[model samples]
Target: MARFLLRRLVTSVVVLFGLGVVTFLMTQVLPGDPARAAAGRNATAEQVAAAASRLGLDRPLWDQFAAYFGRLFQGDLGTSVVTRRPVLDDIAQALPSSVELVLAAMLINVAIAVPLGVYAAHRRGRFADVAARVIVLLGAAVPVFWLGLVLQLVFADRLGMLPLTGQLGFGREVPEITGMTSVDALLSGDLPAFGDAVSHLVLPALTLAAAFIAVVARTVRSSMITVLDSDYVTLARATGASERRVVIRHGLRNALVPVSTIIGMQLGWMLGSTVLVESVFGRTGIGAYAVTAVLQNDLYAVIGTVLVIGVVFVLVNIVVDLVQLWLNPRLRQPARGAAPAPAASLAPGAAAEAGPAVKEGAVS
Candidate 1:
């Protein structure tokens, strides 16, 4: 486990490094120059040049990379050209909103999808199963922006049941003790603020979660079906286990590893890829922050945001791996313990390290 975790950490570092490089180069190759963007349109040539020089854009690309990399190591994400604030600070402020949004969406998705999936699998090939399939198809087929718009139009604009925009009511302010609006509101014991926060969150969170729930439900349903048909499940059934116990304790428990893995892998996607949802809902989050950075041609902000997203992706995967190992102890063991490596299979250096071959039960 230690070795596996160490290996994963090293691989994550390499992946994140590559992500930073690719993101930096992509942002660099974008049409508008950040320095010029920082300088107003009315600025003279010398003023633009001065801004470029100040931002170190006048330096060689490699030099700029080195400086940026050094700053990254020191927890500096550089200053946002448009906002005139540290990119790090902006990210810090925005990250909580994204976190709150993603977590709420995932919770909603799992709460709906998991039980529905299990029930669909339990009644495989029945009306329930077909209905589940249709739901998944519709959910996956719907575009995020269109779904968000339609939701707002129906629930907010037409029905007037929910707020159209923002994370809270106009006048119902909650302390930012935690960055999450609902959480902070709840913590502050402001029932009205909390109620307003939930009202504002409903459409956006549900819209964001819809596709994810579909995908997860399908995956879970398939895995559960296979688990139900397995020999152990048959044995459990023969042993006079109740149908519910057989399904929940035996089938669902064995099937959940895959579902957990999928959910974990989607965490970053939920958190970082909700740009359209955030826009439609008029919520201030990392997604909105990144969108602004891109529109303003703020290369530093773009790179920083991308780096954070990449890091989150890596971290989520690590958590998934750990969960998988915890749920399936067999995953930690050698796949084929009956076979041992032959001397000829060893590389020259490994061969040198090997003293001699031994009998199956004998110590060398």
Candidate 2:
């Protein structure tokens, strides 16, 4: 485990380095003058020149990159071209909102996906299973922005059941313990504020969770089906274990190992997708911040946003790997210079052949 963790940390550093370099080049390629964007449209040519010099844009490309990279070590992300505030400060304020949004979406995904997927696997060819499959396909197929719009129209505009945009209703405020409105509200013991915050969150969270739900549900369904058909599951059934016990203890428990992996990987994708969701919902988050930075050609702000996302992705993956190790103890054993364990098949008496510890571990 120590060796694996060290390798992961090294790989994460390499990935972040590559990400920073690529983001810098991509920003350089964006069409527009960063100096002019920074100086404003009405600024004279001399002022633009001064801004260029101040920003180090007047230097050679290699010097500019060196300066930018060096500043990173000092925890300086420079001032945003649009906001004229430190880019790092802006990111600190915005990151919590995106984290809150993504976490809420993941909670919804797990709540719906696990039960729905398990039921679908059990039902197999029934009408309910077919309907679940169709819903999953549609959720995956629909674009997030379009889904957010439809949800806003139906739930907010037409039905007036939810707020149209923003994190809290007008005149509803919570003392900011965290940038996340819902969490801050609860922390401050403001039930009304918390309720309002949650209502605003419903549409955006659903929009962000749609694709993730589909992906996770499909994975759970498939994994459950495979586990249910395994030799240990069959032996448990033959030994007069209740059906629910067989499914939950022997099947779902083992199947969740792969689902944990899928959830972690999907989080990385969801970070990117949050851009569209926040745009449609008009939420002030890192995604919305990135959109503004891109449109205004704010080089430092854009790079900062990508760096934060990349770091979060790497950290989430590390946690997931640890969870996987816990779920499968075999992963903890070094594969090098180790004899292979015998694999069991689905044939009768395979559980007995595999040994008592293996049989109990499979079911317990």
Candidate 3:
């Protein structure tokens, strides 16, 4: 297990390094000059040249990339050409809102998808299954921005029940705990502020979660169906296990392996999808910042954001891999006679061997 973890960590680092190189190269190849963009249309040739020199844009692309990577290693993300602010600071400020939005969306996705999937699997040929399929199709077909606009119109304009824009109430100043307005409000014991934040978050979160929920539901339902037909499930049923118990215990637990993989991949999809959702909802987040950086040709900010997102993707996948290994005994244990146990395995054979068994039972 320790070796497995070390291998995964090393792989994650390599993947992140590759991502950084790709991002840096892509930004370098982009058409517009960052110095010119920073200087604006009214600036003279000498001004643009001076700005380029100041930003090291006048340096060779390879040298610039090397310098960028060097600074990155030291935790410096450089300054935004447009905002003139440290890219790291900009990301730090913007990341919390994006994280809050994505977290809420994922929560909504899991809450809806898991139950619907289980139900659809259990009622495979029934109307419930058909309805779930239809919902999934519609969710995937509709664009998030359109959904956001429609939701904003109905809930905010027509119903007049929720705020149309922003993260908080007009008069109340919500604390910025952890950078997530909703969490901060709750932490501050400001229930009213929390409620307001939740209200505003509802439309955007639902809009973002719709497609993810569809994907998760379908994946889980398929996995569940497969698991239900397995021998253990049949044996459970033969032993007079209750229908619900057989389905939830023997079936769902087995189905989690595939479902969890999909859930992990969905984190990346959710982050990518947030760009449009944030724009439509007028939320100030990393997505919005990324958009602004691209439009202004702020290469540093763009690269920094891409690097941050790539790191997030890699970390999430690593966590998922570890969780999967923990949940599935087959992943943590070697096949019989496949290889001799590592030294770490022998030190506490009795205790260490029990780890997989305990994890399996816990997950199951």
Compared with the true structure, what per-residue lDDT tens digits does model 1 show for residues 1-364? Answer: 9989999999999998888788768757878767777787678899899998987889999998887678778888878888889999999999999888999899899999999899999989999899988987799789999999999899898999999999987867888987999999999998888888988888899999988988899999999999888755665565565888778877887789999889998898898768888998999999999999888778788888988988899999999999999887667985685765554332222233233322331364
Which candidate number maximizes lDDT?
Answer: 2
Residue by residue across 62-122, what tens digits does model 2's lDDT show? 9988987898878788889888899999999998898889988988999999888999999
Task: Give one digit per residue, the lDDT tens place, for model 3 in 82-183.
Answer: 788899999999999998999899999999999999999999999999999899889979988888899899999999988898888788877677999999
C-alpha lDDT values of all predictions: 0.84, 0.86, 0.83
Q: 357 in model 2: Cα distance from truth in Å?
A: 12
Give me the overall lDDT of model 1: 0.84
Candidate 2 lDDT at 126 equals: 98
Clashes of each: 0, 0, 0
Clash pairs detected, candidate 2 = none
Worst 10 residues of 1 by lDDT: 345-354
